[model samples]
Target: MTSFRLHKAAALVVVIIALAIGSTAPVTARDSSSTSKHVAKRIALMTSQKAAMDMLTGMAAGRSTFDRSQARAARKQLIRSTGSIRKHFRKPHLDPRSNAQPLIWHAWKDFKARAGTAEAAAKDLNTGSLSGLRRTLPGLMQSCLSCHETYRSTPNSFTTH
Candidate 1:
């Protein structure tokens, strides 16, 4: 098969993997009640960011076709989501369901700086072409992973669903 077809097949496989990894459903109302409004909003914001990242990463990794419009949209979503990180976590709201670590509140300045780094990375992402995405997406992903490593609590199974 052609490169495009291979990428398409890979994209399908990625989607299947995402579903198998429990990305198919949002937290139910019962779960929502376990967390505060601030915590819930923060979780939602992170979820949105994750979705956009998944799309962009799939393209950058040659697992999906590079559609400029879709890439741009994902980039935009990331920018917005990163911009909101501070607002969402402004309060030290915590709940059993929240994955945010206490260190995030203790090291507030560092957390904000990391959020700023993520925002900058989102703004820096270039969706102009596949090459641009391959070049810039890793930085953005790294920023996210850096913050998560320091601030996010380890999930029991890496699934929110």
Candidate 2:
């Protein structure tokens, strides 16, 4: 495979692993009950975004056939989910179930900006063709990774039940 293809493959694997870990990881009792609802909402939002991303990534990685309508639907879902990220994280609610770093609250503006970038990338995604998806999906994935690397705590860093 070409270097670019290898890079894309690596990114796809990272995203898949993240989603897997996030989905199955149990919640601990490290946080207060008051913030649990907020954290749950945040997790649900992220889960939805991950579901959409999984579909696009599958098509991009040639693991699944690309249907233009399905790709477009995923693109729309991403656009909506990314657009809501700032609102979802506006509160500094930390829960044991959350992988969010405290730095997110401290670096609020930067986090919002990163979310905006992801939203823009989602909106720019071209689902009209598989080629378009292959070309543009990396930008969206990169935007997500850029924010996640800085704002999300690894599952291993926190204790889980």
- Highest lDDT against the true fold, candidate: 2
User: Which lDDT tens digits does candidate 1 get at residues 9-123?
Assistant: 4344334434544633434223434244456556657666777888998999989999999999888888987988898788888764567899888999999999999999999
Each prediction's whole-model lDDT (CA): 0.75, 0.76
Location of the lowest summed lDDT over 10 successive residues in candidate 1: 26-35
RMSD to the true structure for each prediction, in A, is 9.5, 10.3
The segments of candidate 2 whose C-alpha lies over 4 angstroms from its true place after superposition are 1-34, 155-161
- State TM-scores per candidate: 0.76, 0.76
